[model samples]
Target: MSKSVNRVQKALEDLKLDATIQHMPESTRTAEDAATACKCSVGQIVKSMIFEGAETGKLKLLLVSGKHTVDLEQAAEVFGEPLIRADPKRVRSETGFAIGGVAPLGHLSATDTWMDTALLDHDLVWAAAGAPNAVFSLPPQELKDATASRIFQIG
Candidate 1:
């Protein structure tokens, strides 16, 4: 395995998750790509998105369903204001990975991760694993624990 894949595998292993990181034969940067490769509903693909908090205005990761968009009004009710899409520089500084390749876990810091409650509806979900061409399968709860995320109505 490549060092990048190894790091992601190590992190998932450390969490004791029953998941294996697999390199996609094609680009797996988008949730649609992952869904196509995994042959699952786009809704079953968990997209870990980076956003800037409007309050502290810091960058954070939000794991949402591929089938929907983050309801900003609802997010604001909890977070105090609309969130902004995080830029590339801040994404790398915070998550230690580029935007298109960011994983749901293994960030430089926790950065207030929020897992979309919509994900809990699926028995399994796919997440990017350190690189755009890599992915992994796991139950939603494992991702929540791995990322230290709180469950929220993100969609």
Candidate 2:
């Protein structure tokens, strides 16, 4: 397996998540692409988004529903602070992947991660496996349990 796949596999094992990764030939870098590739609703794809917290000066992860836009104002209002979209350079520097393919956990650095409530509504969801052309489908609760992510409606 490639380095990205290996890392993702290791991450899943380390987290004790008994989920199988379903790799596809097409790129799952974007929500639209992932939805098409996985043959699922757009909302069934987990958007592992990153943001830079100006107040805390740290990286943040917002696992939002694929179909919903990341509402910055709603996020700010709920979190009581502004959440700035991270640049590609910053995201790659922190997460070891480009913007469209960053995963929720297994990041090189510590990031405050929050899973969307919409994800919990789904039986399973698709997430990037470190690369654009890679993906994994697993139970939503399994992901939340494995990642230890906070349940939030921040977006």
Candidate 3:
């Protein structure tokens, strides 16, 4: 496994999760691509998005469902401040993973994270495993617990 995959696996193990990361023959960089590769509904893919606190400059993770786009206005209201889509450098430095493969766990630092409530509708959801071509499937609630994510309405 690549270092990225290893990092994610170790993190999951450390969390005592039964999820197993699987490597794909092709890049699962986008929600559509991942859905096709995993043979699951688009809504079953978790998009680990990073946003910067407009004033604080701290990173926040948003585990959104692939089927919907985040409502920025609602997010700002919930955060009590504006949110900016983090730049690539900030994403890599803070999360230890590049764009398109940021996992919900194993971040370089502890970040405030929220998960879309819509994910709860699915029994299993797929998340990036610290690499674009690697992913893991786990129960949505289990993932929420493992990542310490607060469930929220994203869109």
Candidate 4:
């Protein structure tokens, strides 16, 4: 396994989660692709997005459902400041994963995390496992707990 994928696997183990990372021949980089590869509804895919607080330059993680997009204005209110897209380089450096495979857990640096309430509607959701083609499935509540994410309507 690649180091990126291994890191995510170790994270799952640390959480005492039995979720298994699956390496698909096809890319699971995009939410649509992941849902297709996992044979699930598009809404069941977790999109791990990173944003920067414009004022503080602090990174924030958002675990949103595939079917919705984050509203920057609302997010700014939730974050207590304006938000900007985090640079890809900074995201990788801080989270230890690239844009297409940023997982909800196992970050190199801790960031404030929030999960979209939409994800809780699903029993199982798939998240990228630190590689474009790697992913794992777990209960939505387990994911919320593992990441210590504050649940909110992110989109």
Candidate 5:
């Protein structure tokens, strides 16, 4: 297994989650790609976005349904600061993953995470597992609980 895959597996094991990580021969780097690979709807893929808090300069994570987009204005209202997209270097330093495969959990640094309420509509959701070709499936609620993510209504 690659280092990225191992990190994801270790994170799952540490969390006591039984979900298995699957490696795709093709890249599952984007929502469309992952959804197609998993044979699921676009909305069932979790897009983990990382941002930097403009005020605090801290890393923040947003887990949203693949079919949805996060409203930065609404997020600013909730966080009391504008969110800036983290650079690839910053993303990897904090999350242990690159732009195309940032997972919702197992960060190298502590990160504040929020989840889109829309994801709860799905029974099963797929998310990146620390690499472009690695993915994992879990119940939406279980994923939320595992990450201790607060619920937010994303656009």
Candidate 6:
């Protein structure tokens, strides 16, 4: 396994989560692709979006459902600052994963995390496992707990 995928697997084990990481031959980089690969509804795919606080440069992680796009204005309000897309280099440096495979947990640094309430609509959801072709499934609530994410309707 690649170091990126191993980090995610170790994170799952550290969290005591029973989820298993799967490496698909096809890319699971996009929400649509992940849903198709996992054979699930689009809504069941978790999109891990990273945004930077414009002022503080702090990173925020948003776990949004595949079916929805985050409202930046509302997200900024909830985040208490204007947000900007984090540079891919900064994202990888801080989170230890690239854009297409940023996982909800096991970041190189702690990040403020929030989850879309829409994700809770599904009993289980698939999230990227630190590689473009790697993913794992777990209960949405377990995900919320594992990431210590604040629940919100940001998406």
Q: Look at candidate 5 and give me any clashing residue pairs.
A: none
lDDT of 3 by residue, 1-155 (tens): 76777888999999899989998889899999999999999999999999998889888899989998977777677776788889999789878999998998888789999899999999999999998899999999998998889888854
What lDDT is reached at residue 55 by model 2? 84
Flag clash pairs in model 4.
none
lDDT of 1 by residue, 1-155 (tens): 65556777888888888898887789987778889988899988888889898787877688888887876667678666778877899888767888888888777776888888889899898988888898998888778877888888843
TM-score against truth, every candidate: 0.90, 0.91, 0.96, 0.96, 0.95, 0.96
Clash count, predicted structure 4: 0
| lDDT of candidates 1 onward, in order | 0.82, 0.82, 0.90, 0.92, 0.89, 0.92
Candidate 5, residue 9: the lDDT equals: 92
Clashes of 2: 0
RMSD of 5: 1.1
Better of 3 and 5 by lDDT: 3
**Every model's Cα RMSD, please?**
1.7, 1.6, 1.1, 1.0, 1.1, 1.0
Query: Per-residue lDDT tens digits of candidate 4, residues 17-129?
Result: 97999999999888899999999999999999999999999999999999999888776677788889999999999999899899999898898998999999999999999
The lDDT, on a scale of 0 to 1, for candidate 6 is 0.92
Superposed model 6: Cα runs more than 4 Å off? none
**Segments in model 5 whose C-alpha atoms lie over 4 Å from true places:** none
Q: Write the per-residue lDDT of candidate 6 for residues 1-155, one digit (tens) a residue.
A: 87888999999999999999999999998899999999999999999999998889899999999998877777567778888899999999999999999999889889999998999998899999999999999999999999999988853
Q: What does candidate 1 score on TM? A: 0.90
